[model samples]
Target: MSEPTAFLLAMLAIYTLPWLLWRAAGQRSWLPLVVVQIVGGVLAGPAVLGAVFPDAHGALFTPGVLGALGGIASWAVMLFVFVAGLELDLPDAWANRRDTATTAGLALIVPLLIGAATAALVMRDSVWMGVGAARWQFLLGVGLACAVTALPILLLFLERLGILRSPLGQRILRYASLDDLIVWALLAVILVDAEMLGRQAEFATLFALATIAARRLFARANERDRIPLALMWLLVVALGADWAGLHYMVGAFLAGSVLDSDWFGIPVIDEWRDRILTLLMPVFFLSTGLRTRWEMGGMDVIGVALALLAAIVVGKRFGVLLAARILGWAKGEARLIGWLLQTKALIMIIFANIMLDRGVISPTAFTALLLAAVLSTMLAMPMAQRAIAARDADKG
Candidate 1:
């Protein structure tokens, strides 16, 4: 088959297969469609499909088709990350500073420490570290991936739980929002390249100046023009960041972080985000799946994934429970909050992708992190539902 035709067929399958499987499971999967999309990607990837049906896999994902898919995946992730950046509502987080800071701090720090320790243990074999990465870089990169929370995915889950506008949900948002900021900032710090320090510095300086000018321009612009202007801004920042060796994903986040979501109309922005996720992000997941490997041994990778999942779940639970005790919250609040905040899906996967791209973690490490993320996300809903239901039963 022609490459273009194969690519089109691949796209068709990528979008359809996950949704079909999702429906086949009676359309009430414990895992969200997004999570299923990821699982489908893994199943379709070289590790499974390519290993089992090598000829078909090779024919469908030729070099040219893979290159085309890569390009689309990169842009799709950039846009998705940009939407994440734009959604940050720092003012609300700061207004509830005590709660936000305390919870966010405990939630982030405890897991980070545990994840760092896990990284240290894994690195004792020297096979888990990425090429050209120092021990600290590897440790920090892996640590933060565990610490991440997918705020958007959390929102989706909360809506399903019928608490999206509830006090509990809002509170979770604040905690996740504050921690999201820290995650991105720490990511930038970890990605700083010594050799490209000058380039990065230049990008930072220029980005600051551009942010001010762009904010002013956006404030005065009509609603109709804001979307295009935002896209233009996304391109500029992505190009500049890539050139500066900071990676385009970082650039994408920074670009959107400086813009006000209100300026673009919250409804419109939300719609755009949904549309992008629907149309483009499946390709990104597929590309990510293509990169997975079990070079360190499948058993070893599974062991590491399970260990990392435990550290993340336990650390988050312990930390949030400690915070609840210190703050004198009602009973069972800690369990609910911890389960919600420990949810890791899209954002954590994005972080791991960046770490892998920068050679701060090997493919084996990336696979482990990816598996942990999927499992953790799939667990979030059922656990939180049971916790909340028990709390209500006790109240009754």
Candidate 2:
């Protein structure tokens, strides 16, 4: 078959198959569409579909076709990350700094330390660490992966639960927002390339100046013009970051962080984010699946993934419970918040992808992280619902 024909077929499958499976599963809240899409990507990837039907997988995912799909996936994820940065409500976080800082700090730090310890144990086998990674790099990368909360997915869950505008929901958002900023900052630190320090320094200097000017320009531009201008800014910053040896997604997040979400209007931003999720993100998920490898043995990868999941669950719950005790929150608040914060779908996957790109984690490690992320996310809604039900029962 022609490359174009194959690419078109791949696109069709990517868009349709996941939704079909999601519907077939009766659209359970715990098993969200995004989680299904991710799992679909994995099943269709080399570790499953390719292993089962190598000829068909090879024919459909040709080099030319995969390359074409990859370009779309990269842009899709960059836009998603850029929107995530733009949506951060740092001002609110600052306004509620005492509570937000305490919760977010402990929430992030505990999991990070636990995950790093897990990484240390896992790394003893050597197969889990990337070829070029220092021990510190692998440890920090995995630790951050465990600590991340997917802000976008968290928003979706909040809205679904009908508490998006409630005090509790807002508090959760503030905590997640603060943690998101710190996690990304640490990722930047991990990605610092010694060999390209000079170029990175130059990029940083230029970025700072450009951000000042761009914010001013954005302040003056009307809504219609702001859309294109934002995309232009995203492209330029992403390019510069990649050229400077930091990943483009890092640049993408930075591009959006400096601008105010009010500039684009909240409704417009919401619509854009929804549209991107509906139309473009599936390709990115598929691309992620294509990168999965089971070279460490399937059972071994599953074992490590389960271990990471346990660490995340125990560490996050302990940290948040500790904070709740300190702040004198009502009983059960910590458990509810902790489960909600465990939504690590896209953000953690993106983190692992960056590590894989920089060779800080081996493909086997990446696969483990991916599995852990999906499992953790799948648990969030159901677990949160149970928490809420239990809380209501106590109140009644």
Number of the top candidate by lDDT? Answer: 2
In candidate 1, clashing pairs total 0
- Report the lDDT tens digits of candidate 2 across residue range 113-165: 99999878865788888897888989999999999999999999999999998
TM-score list, all predictions: 0.97, 0.98
List candidate 2 stretches off by more than 4 Å: none
lDDT of 2: 0.93
Candidate RMSDs in Å, in order, are: 1.2, 0.9
TM-score of 2: 0.98
- Residue 392 in model 2: lDDT: 88
Model 2 Cα displacement at 13 (Å)? 0.9
